[model samples]
Target: MTKKTRYGVKFYSVCTTDDYGLNLQIYSGKSDEAEGLSKIQTLVHSLMEPFLDSGHNVFMDNFYNSVDLSGKLLKRKMHTTGTLRQNHKKNPTAITQAKLKKGQHLSKRSKNVYISNWKDKLEVLAVYH
Candidate 1:
């Protein structure tokens, strides 16, 4: 049940949500046996198994978002959208490093996925669509 921060360090479980807000306990991040990305993969699978092949969409913030994770979820017939970290593996470098003036935005898409980046304040925001 750890929380996500702008720094992109994640240490937690995966929860489910709906229009009413968080609706279920998908996985508990109470295990010490697993570490690093493997742990995240495990948590995501467990959290998503019940809805597999149901064509559900999962939305999360940066800490739980990654290109690999999204691909895996897609294979299970679950779609994902979230804020992605600029340095995430497979993230396009041009979008991540682009220096956009205020109000400027950049976007790209491949198949069912689209990525958008915009300048906000002093930082760039990367979103998965």
Candidate 2:
């Protein structure tokens, strides 16, 4: 989702392989949400409820990607590919500590999860499993 400030409603949506809308949740700001999982992770899992265990691929942005979350999704037969925040928790030490040049990148795997950090004008992290 875009972080740019805009005057309008926002919605989190799940789509099919062909880009068909499958399910959607209207964003209502962070209030009175569930207690266990973080709101975004909860929202992602719930949106994906119907499609779990069917080998679906979920693509998301940095706001929705993290190491633990990707592993959990993998266990449910779902694959996730998304941009990761540089300061995200639970990142592999080798990949995170590597010094990559402008055209270089580092990749490491733990179980089924593979995390990559690439440097261009700025450093970028991508996670998938």
Candidate 3:
């Protein structure tokens, strides 16, 4: 008999704001990646609809990065900022020769930057820790 491997696993997470950092909302489920994302979107919409309706800013990680997701949040009038993954390929020009001229310095850097869909450009910033 041949052995089979299970590909899906239950993912759990607690979504909250940067200000408070911890809120009493936890979600867990056993599903594929797409289903997990859909569940998260539904949960976020339900929990954050009021805040979004009142014009609040919502910060998220790149895991939730998508044009559709961004559009949905923007439709609710919420601003967002997050560290986008390099593999996202949202900004092709962001990794040009000019930007990567100093390969060594750039390789070990994780800088605070702003990327916008409107302009599709990156603006690096100096943030105080």
Whole-model alpha-carbon lDDT for candidate 1: 0.68
**Candidate 3: RMSD over Cα atoms?**
8.8
Worst 10 residues of 2 by lDDT: 31-40
- Candidate 1: stretches off by over 4 Å: 1-37, 122-124, 127-129
Q: By TM-score, is 1 or 3 better? A: 1
Per candidate, the number of residue pairs that clash is 0, 0, 0
What ranking of all candidate models by TM-score puts the best one first? 2, 1, 3
lDDT of 2: 0.86
Tell me the whole-model lDDT of each prediction, alpha carbons only: 0.68, 0.86, 0.46
Per-model C-alpha RMSD: 7.1, 4.9, 8.8
Q: Which of the two, 2 or 3, has more TM-score? A: 2
lDDT of 3: 0.46
TM-score of every prediction relative to native: 0.67, 0.81, 0.45
Candidate 1 vs candidate 2: the TM-score winner is 2
- lDDT (10s digit) by residue, model 3, range 7-121: 6644334356544543344444543344534755666665565577566666666665433455566666765555444454333343322242222222121232334322124
- Write candidate 2's Cα lDDT for 1-129 as tens digits: 979887888888898678899999887777554555677778888889998999989998999889878998999999999998877678887887788899998898988899999999988899998
The lDDT-based order of candidates, best leading, equals 2, 1, 3
Candidate that would win on lDDT = 2
Can you write out model 1's per-residue Cα lDDT over 1-129, one digit (the tens) per residue?
988755434434445453453334433346543344466666667656677889988887887777667777777788888888888777777777888898888987755566778776865544554
